[model samples]
Target: MTEKIAIQTKNISKRYVIGTKNSKPNTLAGEIINFISTPIRNFKKLRSLSNNTTDNTKTIWALQDIDLTINEKEIVGIIGSNGSGKSTLLKILSKITIPTTGEALINGKVGSLLEVGTGFHDELTGRENIFLNGTILGMNKKEVEENLDKIISFSGVSNFIDTPVKRYSNGMRVRLAFAVAAYLEPEILIIDEVLAVGDSSFQKQCLGKMDDVAKSGRTVLFVSHNMESIMTLCTRVIWIDEGKIIKDGDPVSVVNEYLETTNTISETNINLENINKRGGDGSIKFTNLTIMDKNQKEKTQFNIGDTLNLSISLKAIEKGLLNSNLTIKILIKNQNNTTVLSFNNESYNHFIKLDDKNNKIQFSIPKLPLGQGLYSISLEVWVNGGKADTVGDVGVFESTPGDFIGNGIPDQEHSLFHTNSVWS
Candidate 1:
């Protein structure tokens, strides 16, 4: 007897060419000349990069020498940083793109929902696109017709099922795309982070459907930024970093390693795409998160008595958003990931209203009451009675010693918080 493999890769690699500016071209004339000479310059640059540099600078390997095997019926969670090649791997497996140097072996039919409108044509109606997506997944007309009703009902798009998908919102497309991918019952399912486009209720349903698929002995490859979801759903995990598989095994252990690598403290703007555990209703998107003291200084270490200010920068996707229609929540947890304190700006009652155009919001903690330990912050924003955006483990800061009183000592604790209580 032989062990079965659901998917396997043999030294798989993918490469892409990107351009860099010449240090000598800052003027308009230089720019024109550079543009004219782009081809020749690229050839020369390629030649130089090949001159025994060992740098491989001419092209970037989105995936490099990746070799792995996923057993049948295994729900494998893939985790990585932004541009770490998770998407490239899936694209290779799904036959959306070919690997540059290696081969990927797929033993089962794959139904993938890689993007919001993937496998959907703008001119096609929602019903037509569902069949189109199923066809692209290798299902025939009769096969798709059998599952058509269930797909439409699961997507909650019956009202617009006959309407062109070109008019559908991102959320609507995601609902239909997920329905086609999950309900068609392919042998292997490959999902990216597109589920984040829909509302929370639908996201839960998508997860449930994937769970049911996994239980039916189908292979699943899940990519998410949500640690909680990955932990709950994946039976195995693979950690990709810098286009290579760094760790492959237990979901809990691999996820813990991924979280440990993300910057606990960041001084500059945040790259939102790297955060897969994030989702919203396409109203507002967070761009940067910074933690500073009252003096406008940047640092992650704060004293118990210090005024900690968390600055969140965002962009308004549309207009007509009144300040009163939005609500923001900022929460802090201890090293153990426990919610020690949470503050809510009741969207309806908070005094400070959103500017509708204001890109930055600050949450000020006056005389912080925390013990000496590492703390994490999570953010949730709501608009018009719906979740607008959410980020988990956004920033981590250290609570140091403080002298709120005359003595310079720190309130130390491993539990929730440290408080000063007097005898009655």
Candidate 2:
């Protein structure tokens, strides 16, 4: 018997138009005037639409000629950087949005948990939303009634099943959302970053449930920034970069390839001014961020035992901003996107006060203690009781495999670190 194709896309692309500036009116009166002038604007748009020309500044291709096939019962993970169009692909597959050109075929019904409380009514109770979601997934009243208890049990939100979803926290919202989609028995399951809001244990439960779904001969497409979950649950992985598939294959290899190439610090100096790569308040901003070896050599690849230095240059926009409770944090995450190590001034009993507009800070590691794998660096700054900046997977570097200890062979691939052993 030949395996069936679960999904196929041919020359599929999605284009969106975003105005360079706010084109809509800001006030009620202005909106009324704009509504009255809609006829003139429609004429202009109609003439432009007839021609092939458009406002070039307003057009962006989220997906470009994406071609791929997913077989039945296959588990695929999609990985990409921010704005690389991972979510857009999921939306397209889930039928949330139509493509601008080309076509895609899905062989079965789909249940997608794209965001927290997806397809949920804010004023409705959890129990009501569960039924509503089931109906949306094409289940009848009797079918939903039969599976209602199971969904509630799986979500572990039985106590709050009668409570309105507006009162639920982010974690609670996602747990219920995932439970509804998975329990509906959709032949094709899709999830996007649903585990981000859940706690560690909840995330584990969700992963296990999704694994069970795939094992039951159903197709699954998962997208997440948590590399660990993708590596653990996915049989295959696809790395998307700039709205295109750059690499697709095994999980470990694809993830490593994505980390090595994306946001790489290849030069000695990296400019940061006016770069909205991260989210934060405007009280302060980073000017430049640099990574180097102990000898002041610019590189992203390091030996297991080599020293690494991170230099950060920043400036305060407001006067006397640095004299307040401002703290900088550095986090190191492994290939699975799990935080393995973190550093801050409070933990080290070190203090830094902002006395001038321009400031430089350095965090040096005597020896890198990570295993032979790629690790990503995350940075955050908090000032005046609010976050100044928060960035994830911003920079990545590889630690070369080496025998740091006097052993004949290096540690296993599953090892988190290489350390000396005293066996008597």
Compare the candidates by lDDT and give the number of the best one.
2
lDDT for each candidate structure:
0.77, 0.79
Residues 1-424 of candidate 1: C-alpha lDDT, one tens digit per residue? 6768989999998886543334456689988997999899778778764343334543577899999999888999998765689999998998888888889888988887687555689999999998888888777999999999999999998999999999998788888887887766778888886655578899899878867887898889988767787888899999998799999999999888767666365543455545644556546667678888898777788877788887887666554454546678888875444478898877337654566567678878878778777777888888777877888767888887775543566544444354555778
Per-model TM-score, in order, reads 0.64, 0.66
Choose the strongest candidate by TM-score.
2
lDDT of 1 at 233: 86
lDDT of 1: 0.77
| Model 1 misplaced regions, further than 4 Å | 24-55, 263-292, 296-298, 302-424
Worst 10 residues of 1 by lDDT: 49-58
Alpha-carbon RMSD, each predicted model: 10.8, 7.9
How accurate locally is residue 359 in candidate 2, as Cα lDDT from 0 to 100?
Answer: 84
